[model samples]
Target: MSTGSLTGRVALVTGAGRGIGREIAIGLAAEGMAVGLVGRTHGTLSDTLKECVKRGSRGVAVTADVCRPGSVREAVRLVERDLGPIDLLVNNAGQVDAAEVPVWETDPTQWWRVVETNLRGPYNLLRCVLPGMVARRSGRVLNLNSGFAVRPDGHYTAYATSKGALLQLSDNIADSLARYGVVVLDISPGAVATDMTAGMPMFRDNRTWASIPYMVAVTVDVARGRFDGLHGRFVHAERDDLAELVEQAEEIRRTDARTLRLRPYKDDDPMV
Candidate 1:
């Protein structure tokens, strides 16, 4: 929660052009990190870059599509060239295009596209970023997961599958990379009022909507490695304030019981 917590950090945020991504980039910038904004649209990326600058820190913008390996790799190169070695990687680029359609009725191509962006994109960044972090013996990688990863319904099968796979990948990487001091975590923002959720029926009730800035705070906490003790874990934004959530995770880590493995929970499951 300190103003300079991320002062020397350089963060690369995917999907940084708009909505939650833009807010997150700005939030990190406000925290004093040099932020690299990555997005496919030049206009949106430029807008985000300016906003990030206005938010009071160094920033750069890169155009890239997460679904394409070449694009993602190029974005990473650009970030390194413009910013610095990424101290933090926020895998926030993904879409839920298949959310309203039943799995059987979903277009195969679109479903695969969703998988490529939602799952493969994170993997691509992790593969590229891990070596440097491992060699340095310090870094943070936060994979943006979703509530649907566990509580998936018929309509969200493809999107949820992608997120679920991502969560598994995060856990596996955390387990392997811990010795090297690289911490990987899966964070679900959950029901934020971003462009992606504007038209959702649930958003019709204002009381249920969460603002983007709050989720950005969660990203800030995650980037700070607050949940380090519970590496390979998932945190829900709605559960508690950032520090309290981290403390809860630390408590879970301290249990040290053989039978206390974290079972991925459904969205509707009681958090208590």
Candidate 2:
């Protein structure tokens, strides 16, 4: 928190072409951090990269499918070669289920695609770039998450299952990487208006949307190392107060709040 601005930090945001990812990139750049844009589409990536440059910060866009290992590694190489070592990684790239369906009624390929993109995408990015963070003993990672991770959704089975799995991934990484000066978090941006949610019947109009500023603020805090103590926890922008959450770090740790866990089934369940 000593540094007022993210002036010298470098951030890589996947799915940086549109929606929340684009906003995060531009917001970080406005704070004076150079940004590296990654996504599958070259045109949108260029557009976002241009927007970041307009914020008085440098940026580079590297096209890559996060689900592909070779491509993800190549992205890291290109970004580091131009933007310097990435100090922060915003794993914002994600996919929505092609069609909302019950688990038994889902198309197998489409279901797997959702899981692969949402879960394996981050896994690939971490496998590629985490080693550098460990070697330097410093870095921060924020996984774009969703309330569905913890809440059961009858219709959005694939998306919910993937996010639920990702929450545990964040917890595991946070525990393993904290001693290396690396912090990891799962930040749910709430009900943001984005292409992924554009077709949802519940959001037929332009109302009941989460504030973009709220999501951006949380990202900035993570980038600035302001909430390192809340590492490995789930942060829901719609319900949790960031300031208050940070203050309750001790209690959170004690109670194991903001993480996925199993119910004891019975108070005396020793196996649990």
Candidate 3:
């Protein structure tokens, strides 16, 4: 993790108005990447962009909703126009409105809204950004995910379902885009202080929280393509050491670890 590893790179971070998105965008700017802060609120996005500029790098704020394809396309165009081609796209915009409710008890509209924001948001960005990256044969995408995506869960069907699908989407895109020199990563920034998690019952008063710097450092590593071998796989900022993971990169690729999949009843189960 050298200083300025992202020098000359351009990154666009969604949900950058505040919280983890804001922190990571500022962190990337501190690493010398020109950053574009995207959010629905212009004033708040501007606030984050100012913080990034304070770190001594180019930072622009764009107001756009990730769930809207046209808005996302225009946001990408704006970012590229001002900051140069995006070297990294951080898909951090997400929703958790139905997070605390059971599947059977949640409102259909609200639940689907959560799914659309969490799942469709990144797809909208990719539909607009992937073509340019493929043509240029360069780019990287980081999908903000959750461990709950695969682990057992209760009263969080919408969030878990969307994240699981997002994980699969990351793997598929990684595999399809690798030949073009692009990589896709599934990063689960552990329970940190964010608007999304500040009210969680588990962290109501827990003074000690996961370090934002750790996740930012890992993201900077991903931005630099340091763990490309772990592309399409998942990593937890608070759990996995980037250096150690890089060391074990080959084994991870060989075994396809950190991915979501289905397992049969037994290893000896015969295939059709």
Global lDDT of each model? 0.80, 0.89, 0.87
| Per-structure clash totals for the candidates | 0, 0, 0
**TM-score for all models, in order of appearance:** 0.88, 0.96, 0.95
Worst 10 residues of 2 by lDDT: 1-10
lDDT of residue 17 for candidate 1: 94
Question: Of models 2 and 3, which has the larger TM-score?
Answer: 2
Those runs of model 3 whose alpha carbons end farther than 4 Å from true positions after fitting are 270-272
Q: For candidate 3, lDDT tens digit of each residue in 1-272?
A: 33877889999999999888988998999899999999999998988988888888997899998999999999999999998998999999988753466678898999898899999999999999988899999999999998877785677678888999999898777777988988898889888888777776656787877888888887887887787888888988778787788899889888778888666578876641
Candidate 1 lDDT tens digits, 100-169:
7778888898889988899988888877777788999999888877777766567777788898888877
**Evaluated with lDDT, which candidate comes out highest?**
2
lDDT per residue for candidate 2 within 1-272, as digits (tens), equals 22339998899999999999999998899889999999999999999989888888899999999999999999999999998998999999988776666788988898899899999999999998899999999999999999999999988888899999999998877777988989888889898988887777656775888987779877987898988888899989888888899899989988998889887989898866
Better of 1 and 3 by TM-score: 3
Most accurate candidate by TM-score: 2
Error of 3 at 161 (Å): 0.6
- lDDT (0-100) at residue 24 of candidate 2? 94
- Cα deviation at 237, candidate 1, in Å, is 0.7
